[model samples]
Target: MEFFNNHTKLFITAFLLFAGLTLLVCIIPALNNQSNNAPLPMAVPLSDMAIKGKGVFIANGCVGCHTQQVRNVDMDKVWGERPSIAADYADIHRTDFWRNTATLMGTERTGPDLTSIGTRQPSKEWQLPHLFNPRILIKESIMPAYPWMFEIKDKAQPGDVVVNIPEEYLGGRKGKVIAKAEALELLAYLQSLKQTKLPSASPQPAFLYGKVGEESDAKPGATKELNGGMLYTNNCQSCHQQNGEGLKGAFPPLKGSKVVTAEDPELLVNIIMNGYTGREKEGYPAMPPIGTNNRLKAEEISAIMNHERTSWGNSAKKVTVDEVKKLMEKVKVKAK
Candidate 1:
């Protein structure tokens, strides 16, 4: 009894010291950082709706099934970017709070990485439909429908169809209508998943870089190098079509176009490398800038430029590696 009573104060002091240490080491910093270091996405703000949706996301433990970070090895192999950093999370913040915790660093990868999910898929209409019911869009989706997060509504606007809500949903207490605000906020978060680069019109290889360094020129007429055809098929065909007669106004017609078969191939090479818009002299649909597909090699652009000029009735001169080199230099200067 004498020993116990004497040590009681020491034991209490020790316990208090340990608890204080833990609070300072882990709890205090987390609380401080969470209030000050959360992310604020460049695209949109965390409005009341988005905040509510974020609560829903957390309440459902979406992070347990999905991940938001991309490691260096995965980025290099899959998308060619580096891993996540603290700077990337500097967006979410408030005057008094933030959400800067190290989240989604878990063992599960049940769903795809959503770090760049918004940019990966940017269709608001598509996101809404998918959220309404996953099975409708993806037959194999294992995700449960977040019907409770949705509020079914009537046709408030013209052509706005009234979507169905599950009967047991919390939001559908009296079969409440779809809350458009919540849907938009959730979409704002999802639309931010674009992590990959855009598709190129004609991605070229390494050998196409310079003035044919001894390895240039075909082996005695090897059928005009059928290399670039595959690139064209993959990237260009969607708008240009297999026959190259692009959609009337949406995409310019490549066949029989003056720009395609012109005598000087530098213009075409520049168009491919730097991208072209405005009407061609022949008056066709304007092309978009090469914003998405910037990965095409200079040589591939040259080859495809040469191929198009020759194949489509126009006897334009072939665009050589020398020409591509020159034009690429010029484009780089202009880009600067």
Candidate 2:
């Protein structure tokens, strides 16, 4: 007993020493700014909305359900661009280095990863309506209403107020109010969800090439001459016009547009085959996947696009039926 009591102090001293050493190993460099010189690579700055939405995202605990990082194999199969990298979070500055550590790193994801939500769903109006009430858009969603973050304003007043009343209440019923800034911020964060370098591959058809464009770049042949002016008058002139000056802001002006006149003819071919719609900058009322007459073959789409490209001082190479067929296959594969 006497010996055991005597060694208690030694035992305590040894334990304390070990703990102190562990603490030093963890804390010493952090306290002394040892790795502070290793700066993160710069990324594009977030919009004001995105910055605000990030705060809302943190506040509402969306991370409890959704994840940001995606695995490489899953991303490849989904064709979801690159996998999550720590560098992707370089722009996400946080005040407390400790509390915000995961924000700067990553967290465990439970729901479908949000790594590409921005590009997947880019319409601001869609996002706004979706946030006001998720069930309105996604009938099966389990998310709670963020009504507190929105305003209730009357449409009758026609003021500068943004409201969050249910769409049903728009018929002159007194509306509830919410904060526009908060909604805008939440959208900003959602819009920041895209994480890819090439959301859309260049508009080349794949069959013209031996394989998919991503797999190989084998170019296709020149298009065959067809009755382009008659085709335009009968089909395209209604929307695209005889001169190819489409409805400004509604349909794109094909005369000198980048997609039509690029050095690569694939750009024009892909659009005709797939049809597209994005931001105003991207073009609107995207050409229908099927032609206006609905039976225009791959050769027809190619000839028309090629003729348009050359007719308006476009100076780009022409598209061909084989290229159109190739891209059609690629788009179909991607759609799958």
Off by over 4 Å in 1: 1-11, 27-45, 75-80, 91-107, 149-181, 192-336
Off by over 4 Å in 2: 1-42, 47-49, 75-79, 101-110, 155-166, 169-179, 196-336
Q: Estimate each model's TM-score.
A: 0.46, 0.49
- lDDT score at residue 206, model 2, on the 0-100 scale: 20
Q: Candidate 2, after superposition: displacement of residue 291 in Å?
A: 18
Give the per-residue lDDT of model 1 (tens digit) for 1-336.
665677887798789999999999999996887677544233344466556655556656877887776665522222213355543554545333565533444457786666765543344434555576665444456877765555544335654433433354333456434546556567665654434322255232112123334555657644344466666654455456667776443356789988778776656666665566556565443443332233556666666676676665657677776667787777667756
Q: Per-residue CA lDDT of candidate 2, range 1-336, in tens?
A: 665677887798789999998789867865455344322333456777677788788788888777776555432223134555544554556645565623522365444466766754554544565566665444456767675666665443444434323546344546544457777788778877766342254232122112234423434654346666666554455455566776444455778878778776665555554556654465354354434113467766776777777886778777667877787677657646
Clashes of 2: 17
Q: Identify the candidate with maximal lDDT.
A: 2
Model 1: weakest 10-residue lDDT segment is 202-211
Best candidate (score: TM-score):
2
